[model samples]
Target: MSSLVSFFAGAFIGGVVAYIFSRRVANVQFDNAKTRDKSQKKRYKDIYIRASNQRLSLGPYIVAIGGGTGLSTLLKGLKCFTRNITAIVTVTDEGGSSGRLRQEWGVLPPGDIRNCLLALAEDDSSLNRLLNFRFDRGELAGHSLGNLLLLAATEIAGDFRKGIEELNYMLAIRGQVLPVTTESVCLVGRTKNGSRVEGELNITTCGPDLEELWLEPRNAKPLPEVLKAISNADLIVLGPGSLFTSVIPNLLVEEVSNAILNSSAPVVYVCNLMTQPLETEGFSVWDHAKWIAKVLRRFPDFVVANSTPLPQDIASRYIAAGSMPLLVTPEEREKFKKIGVYLIEDKLYKINEEGSVRHDSVKLAECLVRIARSAREREIWKESIQFSGMSG
Candidate 1:
């Protein structure tokens, strides 16, 4: 009985020791597994980051010139293709919250720049909603939070360009936004009836019979950085915005236009989706391209127009508003061919939930990327030919 008791007690102690040892071993294995999982996750993360950086670095350097919703829309799409984008925005806005800020704060218009920044932002959805918030009451009535932020940034940085750069980093935007010029200037236009129109608002609203448009303070200089960007661009895109208000104003700065003319990059003109009531009332795609050529002093290498037909209901609404779709006709294609300009038409339109027609960002971007790639290939071939000639 004594031997039995001793043996049973000894067995119970040994079993406890074995159980404890097993538990320790299991815990150590679990910890090792967790460590390996964390290390593997980190390694994958590093690889993804490196690849993303390489892709962005290898993207073609594209410079987009315009302002307003059109420029922002284009930026939204372009950011997906390349991080090497420079948005050169028009600063002659003299209306809305931007106008008020310009008049009151004595700063260049921030509305367009703000829009471009948001469009290229890393996380646009949340940031856009926050910055685009408008105050409907009190002293800040009719002003956007974004404009105020830009104003504050400008004040803090002590220079408009520096302020914009600061916001570029703060927003973690995919590309940079630059004002066409930092100097304060007004958009001036002359009507076909010889009536002089001053300011972007008057020029846009006065009539579509605008015979001439120029910037006030005639010698307003283009930003040096803007000129450099144009010089280094692999592709330059103009428009898809209001012709007189958003696009032409930038070209009015002689140096900017000159830079574009001299650049080896392929230039593309993105025609607007629809005509504005008083601005482009009866304009067709050809008319739009003609105006651009008139200002640019050269026809763009390519013209991208939407080929998608609008829904009848949507068309009716636009018609009622005195705006019509800017369609590319067969005649326009022949005209473009004569000018040595390639005409690229695609199903680029999308109807939002609100029933308003806009460009399909992804589709438009993809088209532009393809054009850039083609241009790049042609450039390489040309260079190779030159090299072979030198070798021979």
Candidate 2:
């Protein structure tokens, strides 16, 4: 009897311990499930928001020409307005990871192109951060992952354009980004002192006023697609970038300049917020317009400039760096009007995330849309008058 009782007690204790263990495990699993559901709900919310934002993107077909952070900044803002955007980027870059790649693998500089791609990417925030990441150590030091990715894709696709296409599909970019040309072009500038400065990097710090800018291989044919974009665009935008290296270099291509002049689409030049050191040290709004007119032989229909003053802290920093806001005098405004270029000035600048004074993308986009809409309205009114006259 004693043996039987002892065996029964042990069995009861073992069963109770196992039951307690199972209950603890069940509780933990239930908590884990709740956490996963919460994560899924947040992700779903993000997707819903992105989808809703894109519904209002049927604004206009805009073509933006230029390069560097300024061009990309404009692109980032413009995407919110329209899905039909074509960014024509200058590829004369000779600095940073792009410079190294061009020197080693003999490819067109990828830095600016990469930036344009990220700017127009559908998943702008996350992918932009990823592509802009730079390695700090080892052989990859100072190299941008986006530049490397472009280089590899180019090699794999056997051409740069094809590689860009592949990335476009993978990233679901909002609009197209095209190089001005496929040839490895060099930016050459003639300083006012009659000294010649070659290469994009050297021209910026050449310490002289640039009087003329040109590209090597003067006969370089533009990518046919770029011409098509300009011809079909409702509006074309120029500048808000490096005056010599970015904006002028594109015009140096004879065919590209001709396309802009021939197209009925109105051309608008988005002037920079401040004069660059050594390039446009004391440039005013008129100076910027005249230089562009001199090269293209036709003035832009509209010139958009910032009318807002910079914050004192920001102004001081730029002043110390030998830069200042571009002044558009009343006389200059009248002169531009006499020459048929409408001056659209607004408070279009702000301190960007990096704490630098730059064009506010949304504000700039708003200004552009306003001009484009007004132009469209005028055209419609003219057509209506013609129709009424004929019917009468």
Give the count of colliding residue pairs in each prediction: 0, 0
**What is the per-residue lDDT of model 1 for residues 1-392, given as tens digits with 9 covering 90 to 100?**
99999999999999999999999999999999999999999999999978886797788888999999999999999988889999999999988899999999999999999999999998899999999999999999999999999999999999999999999999998879999999999999888899888988888886468888899899999988999999988889997799999999999999999999999888889998999998888999998888889988988888889877888989999999999988888888888888778777777789889888888887777777766766676654222322111111
Predicted structure with the largest TM-score when compared to the true one: 1
After superposition, candidate 1 runs with Cα above 4 Å error: 1-35, 379-392
| Per-model TM values vs. the true structure | 0.89, 0.83
Q: Score each candidate by Cα lDDT.
A: 0.88, 0.84
Model 2 — which ten-residue stretch has the worst lDDT?
383-392
